[model samples]
Target: MSVHIAAQIKRVGRTLTANRAFLECITGVWLLTAATHHYIMAPASVLSQVATDLHITSGVAVWLVSAVPASWAVTNFALGVWIDRLGDYRMIALGVGTVILTGVWSWWAARQGVFSSLLGSRLVAGVAVGVIWTASVNLIGGAVSDINRATAIGVFITSAPAGFALGQLSTPVIASWIGWPASFLVMSGAAGLAFALITDSVRHLAIDPTTNTASMRANFTAVLQHRAVWYGCAMAFAAYSYYLFMNSWMPTYLGQRFALSAALSGGLAAVFPAMGVLSRVGSGLISDRLLGQRRVPVLQAAFLISLPLIVLIAWTRWLALIVTALIVAGFVIQLTFGVVYSYVREVVEADITGTALAFLTTAGISGAFSAPVITGALIEWTGAYLPAFTYAAVLTAIGLLLSWVAPESPHSMN
Candidate 1:
């Protein structure tokens, strides 16, 4: 047993700090990942705090939760290709710098107790998210070899859900002890720490080699014409829509529906992202090892399995059943995130990899927040969670139909 434990420790230690560059990249990604999530989840984690402090309903409070990803989507569309083409060290450094400045603003704005100010701070923090997130994903994807693509993408993305889980788990307790705004302060420190450690590491990353130099319009138009690219974009939109809906609204939903406290509600909601962390790695491994020639099967199964679980959440009154349903839903819903990234990389031209990524992410992030905002307004109009769950079901169905027809990547078989 001791020998086994030692071997496990050695394996983990080797992977985590394999070299200075790897260390910096993973650590920076994890911290910034945590920072983005912590920023939005502060509101989600303390939905009651926003409601009381800002004089808003739970639905209105979620607009603050949705705002970061909305801005992130816009930034992805606006800057993804440009950053991919022209960015590297300076992009990463500036991204980190933006997060630090805006993270502090988020902390302060939330503390001041105004709705618009808090929403504005979250939006600005999202720009930082778009910058850092694009740089980090590009760095990891470009650095690794094609053979290991799924594993690298999967492992790297685990950081986001991990950060989200960390925020969800800790923020409620921190908010309870130190006040809600303090969570943002702690998360800001995390982003600051990442900037300090990561800037130098990014300076050394390998540039993506490319032969295509077409005009932006031609590059985008080319990829857009491919069926696989559309599949990736469509999946991104559906997956992110369901993810953000739950993340932005579930804490408040649990609290209001179950009559639980903020801390407890956050803890319960934390189960979702926590499951996501492990499921992402598992999905990647499945793509890499079990289904090396395909990703659509994994992607399709994820959508099909998630439908009932989502409905269960909206319909069930029993806490144990709801939690169980959420855990399963979380696992199934997250599989596509890691698998499709590798899949997207396989299908798109290397020159516009970032452009394609921007396309996918914008489609995804926009899908993530757009309907939820309307869902918020819908809840105002109808005063029930059924409409949101019904919407999630339809989106998942659409994802399934798309995945069924998704073209298999040639690189995956090669």
Candidate 2:
């Protein structure tokens, strides 16, 4: 009886410890991701202030949002081959450091009111962010068990929207308190704190270094040879294009269309990315538990459902209805994010997962880079918001088609 009781107590203690560790892991990952997002998105929240402060046109100011992704696309493509060799921990550390330094540069430029300098700093930060994104996805996907991979990643993916919401809701307030440029430095400090939280937790997640250049070449070749990767890229391109388009323009749209104050419009625009908090995690659960670990179907459904929602946003005149449409659209469209992150990792070999994700990042952020510029140009061309939103819906249709044909993972836990 004594022996049995002792064993039972030991098992209970182990369970508690495991549960605690799991919670810490989730919190650490979420916060770290959120910090990066807050830094990246802070500018979009105060674009008008930035334009006025720097004396640039709205056309030029839009590039402040676009420049990061533009450089991110190029950097992801160029640096992906080396991620496996450098390992996740080092890459993430480097990314954090780069952003911190860039933050200072941006703050100085903003104080000087140099548009070119501010823009250049954003472009440099984009390079760091690409590696950070690729490595972080690889880390999350590799950290958990196959049984819960999608669910864990789904939860992890929520950080993007959560961070976006945080930046949008907080940046204007922060700018009001300390001016727009200081928001950059403050967000970078937040990133530093977030990095500190995750540093100890993720140290064990670093990849084993590749042996040589030959191995790096092989990893790159292996990822490129996989046909499913191209399909995932197409899906990513569509999803990111739609995601960034809404995030970049919605505040401006709301301000212009409804004659809302900047604070009100920015707060309202946040509802779109905010929906990811539920959609990303829920999609992961639905795919893992309900869909039997099938990812492509979830991806397809997200795109299909989001198409009408994008149209609704374009066509609606009522503010309440537009907000409601944004809520649903944000949830539906963001389902693709967590699913694609998990899907790409599962389809590729473990050794080359980083490379596969790098490709996805490159393709997706290229869409992110393009969407704002294109939408702005379209709105300028047509002198209306309808054509811009229509362009987004068309992108969703393309993504839906791509998702329909994407190959399901052969290693499905189901």
Q: Highest lDDT: give the candidate number.
A: 2
Evaluated against the true structure, the overall lDDT of model 1 is 0.77
For candidate 1, report its TM-score.
0.84
What's the CA error at residue 300 for candidate 1, in Å? 1.5
The per-residue C-alpha lDDT of model 2 at residue 221 equals 82
- For model 2, what is the C-alpha lDDT against the true structure? 0.81
Error of 2 at 302 (Å): 0.6
Candidate 2 Cα outliers beyond 4 Å, as residue runs:
1-22, 203-217, 252-268, 316-320
lDDT of 1 by residue, 44-134 (tens): 6678776888788876887787788888987776576666566544566777777777767877877787778878888887877877776
lDDT of each: 0.77, 0.81
Candidate 2, residue 108: the lDDT equals: 95
